[model samples]
Target: MKNNKPDQQLASRRNFIKGSALAAAGFFIVPRHVLGGPGFIAPSDRLRVASIGVGGMGAGDVRGIFSSGKVDMIALCDVDDTRAKQSREAHPKANYYKDYRIMLEKEEKNIDAVSVSTPDHMHAVQALMAMKMGKHVYVQKPMSHDIYEARMLTEAAEKYKVVTQMGNQGSSGDGVRQMVEWYNAGLIGEATKVWTWTNRPVWPQGIPWPSTPIAPPADLDWDLWLGTAPYKDYVGNLVPFNWRGWWDYGTGALGDMACHIMEPPFRVLGLGYPSSAECSVGSVYVGEFQRGYFPDSCPPSSHITLRFERPGKEELEFHWMDGGIQPTRPEELGPNEMMGDGGNGVIIEGTKGKMMCSTYGANPQLLPTSRTKDVSLPQTEYRVPGGSSGHYNNWVEACIAGHGSEEFKKLSSPFSVAGPLTESVLMGNLAIRSYDYRIPRTGSDNQFDYPGRGIKLVWDGANMKITNFDPANQFVKRTYREGYSL
Candidate 1:
């Protein structure tokens, strides 16, 4: 698909030249205070940012980026006025618009960077547009809605030569870095099995879509809110939240939390795409004994296993559980001890020992808990300033420094790394969706048959295809609405 319009193409070329010129002459440029007022910041010293979906997590992202004291939030965009109110009130000097497309078009030259905190489905389209315009991007976690979008965004970052960061803040945390060091020192040995769990679906899932639609709120531009997703009538409770359960918009539990919970293992193990995927999902009982079938919504609970091939080592078995499901606890812990912060956590079992951590890789501990106190390892990985809290400023500084600079190299979750990780996370979702793939039975006692159940789907990660089941490949990519493309 053509990624840019004629005007956008011109703007992209102009922006590229402008960025190149600024990078070339940055060292020689005079201080802004010398040229203007004492409070003025030089173009090279400040990052002018525009934020899309400036509400919910987006509001926090805006606050974090602005707190860097080196960012000028020049533009803000959101489809809902009520949701954008907080950012608008906070950044009164910034321009505001409901449509991101118009904001990008009008303010293209003014923005040096863009932050996209939209839903999973719209992430690729919004971020791609900014990247094509030579704007550095900080996208929210589960970088894209599908495997294809993730791969495309990964390639685009390199092609555009822009500094990029994904919103999995844990990647920048000291805990993850500490875990990496310990793992490198053979503390956990060679990890063979990894388990991650979450108590999500804090929204709702495994239920049928609302039978009736309601009018969208007066403050909301419902059409714009449904950007890349298929057009659907406004439904109650879907605006501010609750969209996470629907397949049309959100990516369910796996997409919601796996990026945060799975990153430590993914980074420590130097993992790549999975070689195979399979899953078993919890079903809801409808009235009495009948099982609920709602393909349009994510299942209420699920247990997914993915296998990653290692060149010289045994294949790694990675397990993900959601809807309060958890793996069997290691016997090394006391019966009363909490496993993974009581709600969400990760455990990596290796030949020698096991290590565990809570969400975002916080509070990392070795198995038996006592081993964590005496063991020490040299710090091999660079920790981001302020740890996880420094994630926003890290990207801001990197953008100001320009791509390929030293600061850029220190990025925690650039698309190059986030893309593969996100793809792996979404692989679990693929297995879940495939598990619900139903077929009509011909001249049989059963009304419907599920061939995908109880079968391991062989994956060709490079090709983004499920080799064993052709039907499962349908979830790898999706058709966007009429006005959007990626």
Candidate 2:
């Protein structure tokens, strides 16, 4: 009892030292939940957040997070001043910066989280930096450009001890949950096949890159926007959204919309890496006889098939159709009934029945509309407060809870889930790229052998490579620009 007095005095000394160290760091974020567990956090405490690539979809994502009203939008960064106009106007209080590098460096102490919504090539690098600093990160979909990048961020999210999410808002929706419940309830017995399609590439593809480059716009930082891609002069249409067609910048239609459309099947089936992948791309003829091969661009259309193995279940035949393609209608539905919400949808055929859903897993239905009306299953999965729209808040609250907290485990699109899904999506692109590979033949004019054509590539997911087709492995991991790397 007498020694207890010295113990109290030592505790006072420890608190004094801790406060001094924080003072030296200028400012430190002490999430309320960290000070006092879960429910003890005060209502007034707010998450401090920043946005990168605040334009177009990125702008919308930023607004969604802001609308959550749980966090303070502290900073905004984008390469194009013109593109950033809307966000800057909306969050006038936030600090604005042209380069993300500068913004992260100056705002590191103040930021608690970051939203990375840049081009596919930039997602991994930006997200990795924030996580490494122990800041939560919410990255936009397709998760990453290459398989390796996807795996990197997936692993980094845990190693850095930071909460993380990939912006596939559909994953947070009610429809997917309903579909999952239905599957578990045995409504769709044992799924063996799935079909996902999209009408995308609204921008041009299957054409040669423009020969002349235009002067960089005064408001746009072409180099910063380029990020990890090889330096190139600004091309008019590539900005403000046509980048979807290019291999170096975008992942084409599959990357553009698959995350939203294919999420249902991936979730309901409890899928994992595919055992093998193959695809047939729609080709364009350059002239009368020559096939137009734009190595720099994604194909106009593609039909890919991936085979996934389940431990004790039937193997899955997952089909991805893009460039305005559609799957066959299920016989169980009326002829007039819509098949997969018109343009983008997915159909999973099981041993017992079929289930379908539209983009974002919205408008889910059983094969026969009447069946959906009469059927009901016990709801087992948790629904976000606002369904699909609640994706932003899902991350906001998790960041507030502190990484590895119970709330963090509830995130809808944590990299652990998104990483493998993205890898699956990117796997199809590998098949497409390999489909277009050509090798010149000796003693012939414009004649070449396409070795990768018509071959099924066996994937070794553990090693992140194509076990059978060595040439197709190049796209698995991309080379980063010297200055920027994960």
Candidate 3:
């Protein structure tokens, strides 16, 4: 008797991955039942994967996933062919597409996971779509462009029972865990003040949007590239990297580097959302007569303060400075000692002592260089096998092992941890953006009232809202474009 059921044929089609003949024929799969049943995936079974925005950071992510030796990258997508050219040449067999939606639809049966490394504005939408289709996701840091989106993805991961990881590689580093061990060992007493800074926005910020109306590059799909953001004329430099300086397409320096700098303190202090947030942005001189007020772009530099209510102690005061601004030298440091790894660093001031670390939570040290060498603490946390670079393989193996497996729980920056951290990080930007919100003063054509200035915005973490300032609430969640809804 000849037997050929449709479901069996589909399963057969979905089960043959990584063969010269199969790939050359544009078919990829993992022999479903041959490896193992249900939760037990075999060592030889390769997870089929896809990537969106395979250029720049996207290209790095895809390459890392492929390097893990646990997955077969079957599809690659990007809006700009020029940007994706390198990746295409590297993985010519993996189907390439300019439209992610079409790629997902056509390859749904073959893909086991998706990596999203697009612009801040598009991350949530792309990841959300993949999650809805029961695909595991690895998203880049800051979780999302909005606090609401972060919360949604956090909840969705649990709802869909899909393994998830955020691309804050530092969260998996030895430095952060070592700091956590030190903090838990009471080496640094109750943390009362923390400061973090970076020299970012090497791109232009705090200026009017480029008014030049020019055609977009032939290789770039301007409409698709602007996914989730409002339609606008093409501007040079904004597409490749300068977008980080704009509010509409990016989240400024906070989004650019805070996830890397702040993860250590967020983990060691065991902090959550701040009770109140405030900031002071550096001003730019637009014309000789009046100061510039460009809401379209981020400020040239800024200093922000976030207050958290500690369960048993006084409130914690955390400061964030960017655009090369740094705190005064700590007395514990030597005159020649560089503060915070130079250019970017973090300082945690505790009731009894202080600790500091450089970017990516690397090269941690105690104040007064002598203390760093003198003190020793137990390694209380499990060290990530490959350290920071192991971040990609960590997620890939987990997806292969199946969601809710023991291996899955060991992920470094799962949505569970990343969501609150992202929400808290984005909180600082809310304060910075609010500083620019204004209204015209009544009966005065010559004057304007800045409503968001000079106030501490009280936050309701549970609801993701700004209880004190109504206007600032808008940033907690944004209105997406018509086609892209979360």
Selected candidate, larger TM-score, 1 vs 3: 1
lDDT of 2 at 35: 82
Ranking by TM-score: 1, 2, 3
Question: Tens digit of lDDT per residue, candidate 1, span 1-486?
Answer: 766699898999999999899888874566667987777777679999999999999999999999988999999999989999999999999999998999999999999999999888899999999999999999999899999999999999999999999999999999988899989999878999999999997998999889899999999999999998888899887868899899989999999999999999999999999999999999899989999899999999999999999999999999999999999989998899899998899999999999999999999999989999999777789999999999998899899999999999999999999999999999988999999999889987669999999999999999999999999999999999899997
Backbone clashes under 3 angstroms, per model: 0, 0, 3
TM-score of 3: 0.91
Q: What is the lDDT of residue 147 in candidate 3?
A: 92
lDDT at 155 for candidate 1?
97
lDDT of each: 0.94, 0.89, 0.89
Error of 2 at 371 (Å): 0.7
TM-score of each predicted structure versus truth:
0.92, 0.92, 0.91
Pairs with backbone N, CA or C atoms under 3 Å apart (clashes), candidate 2? none
What is the Cα-based lDDT of residue 77 in candidate 1? 97
Q: Lowest lDDT 10-mer window, candidate 3?
A: 35-44
Please give me the total number of clashing residue pairs in predicted model 2: 0
